[model samples]
Target: MAEQWWRRPVLVDAALAVAVAAAVAIAIQVAGEPIERQADFLAYALGGLMGAVLLLRRRWPLAVLFATVAILLTYYSLDYPGLAPAVPLSAALFSAAVAGRFRWAILVAAAVVVGGLVARVIEFDMATLPVASAVITDAALLVSIVLLGETLRSRRERVEAEADRRVADERLRIAREMHDGLGQTIAAVNVQAGLADDVLDKNPVRAREALQVIRQSTKEALQELKTMLTVLREGSETRQPGIDQLDELLDVARKAGLRVTSMTSGEPRPMSAEVDRTVYRIVQEAVTNTIRHANATTVTVELCYAPDSLIIEVTDNGTNTQQGNTSGFGLTGMAERVSALDGRLAADFLPDGGFRVRAELRT
Candidate 1:
């Protein structure tokens, strides 16, 4: 229900300019001419109208300048000094400069001053010294206004751009942390839960072992989450995971009932953090999808590392029933995550009545 600042009226400026213009025109008419004359009456009215237009100088600066200039030129040519037209032009020049168009403001100011000076000199045969001095003063004032405006505009734009970059960088950092910390913790939990389920009916000792692993995994996950929150609040942390942890990740998935086969054909090398994480997440999500969606008795995950690319494939022999799929945000989120790393993810029903998901990330 709050009104926007931009929509609010800036009436004070317009009102002040109009009042000044009206006073000037009234004073001139009272001293030098009869107020009853049509010319004097029209001059004062036009001057007040042109001055009132200054209120819109910030929003429609160029338009305001041209309109004010045209009105003033017409009134001055018609022999009426009622509208002190120079004020609107000065406001517009300053606004334009602040909006980061200094060159344009300077060009307009130059044209106006030069033309006004030439016209006045040729028409009135004015002395060169005074006319040149006034023109130079006006030109200098316009230049100063424009320079000030440009400086402010540049500073504000830089601040906004820096803020945007920082926000984006923070989001990316958070995303990587969540992917590694939460994903690994969840994988360990899944492994222990599976082990517990398998031993619940037969061996009490094995079941307790699984439960202990689950407890440890949960504790680690909590610590990671807490660390993440702390980093979010305080903006510093020394603990971070990298591609070196991929083996432990695979071990966790293996415990959870996925047969993961990882091989590096190329020389072990470093990759960008984004690409490394993308590879890890793609594999993780693919394996998770196999467990959740494939009712197969066996799932196979393969990771092939080449010189310039990492290929990952998750295939399951379980033929999950082709029932109505009412929920699948994980796959959608996975696709988005992969695309953000400039990779492609493909999921489909295998011709052999199974499901497979594949992704390839360029290092």
Candidate 2:
């Protein structure tokens, strides 16, 4: 896998080197002064070296830039032929800039431009106007190449950052799911196990019922856990529990000895997948907390659907040991879910000795 990961870039660099070498040869042949066969061979060899050096650009961008500049300067110093600086130097300058060596690229580019201009003046004794024009054109092209490299570097960084953020978000989502799902299931199982143990010697029938609930809850929890793990490993989408599963959630709570009731008001509207899943998780986490901490016998789950938002309230008629504190992992996960949807969450002890968790989510 590691070898394969590096193969593509190596292949790309090889192709780029070939292209640059070809471009240099074409430029020299088409625009250069006529010379003997031996001199022509030497000129082409030097131009080829400029492109061949690009193979090291990714690992040694500054060195590649320097090598290209030296080769170009040497080519002109020999009075062999005149080739446009853009042909061979552009790739090296762009490579350096993209590798986060913009300063080095800029300095090398300036040196090449000045050196080429001086060589032209000394070799051909060009007029003042022509030299000025050449300088402007070369400077503009070189600057544009550097700017293009910088733009590409910026774009690549932005893309990588976005990808990292998405990975983090997904991990957080899975964590919340594991906490809410497993936590609730285990709480229910604990309640059932206790009931079974108490009734085993007194009422065999009731004890069997509690054990049945435990078996069913564990079965469902294991399946859901398997699905979540599969999604995490394969990066595939799976059907997540939504508000439609409220009945089952309430059933589990009931079997855990809590009188769970749900009430929905206003018109029921469809929600985005994320919103639906979040709503279910919020309710699940709230109920799980009640089961584990509230010591409550009755849980009232209320949903108020409005034109622009949905309000969820889970209230329990039991003592809330933590009172209004939202410090537990369960509450914190709920808050995170609500905040991600641009919503609000409030958890507080009701004045009447019960605890209430309310969340308002935008549709």
Who wins the lDDT comparison?
2
lDDT of 1 by residue, 112-206 (tens): 88887997699768899989887888778877777888888899899999999999977865775676557656755776688789889999898
What are the per-residue Cα lDDT tens digits for candidate 2 across 1-363?
366633698887888888898888887887755562334788999988988999999999999998988898788778765666697789999999999898888888788778768866986699999998998899899988998998899999999999999989888877887898888889999999999999999999999999999999999899879978887777646677899999988888988999988999999999988899989999999998888788899999999999999999999988866745635578899899899899999988887789999999999
Stretches off by above 4 angstroms in model 2 are: 1-7, 30-41, 197-206, 226-238, 323-328
The best candidate in terms of TM-score: 2
Model 1 clash count equals: 2
Q: Candidate 1, after superposition: displacement of residue 107 in Å? A: 13
* Estimated TM-score for each candidate: 0.55, 0.88
Report model 1's TM-score to 2 decimal places. 0.55
How far off is model 1, as Cα RMSD?
Answer: 8.8
Q: Which residue pairs show collisions in model 2? A: none
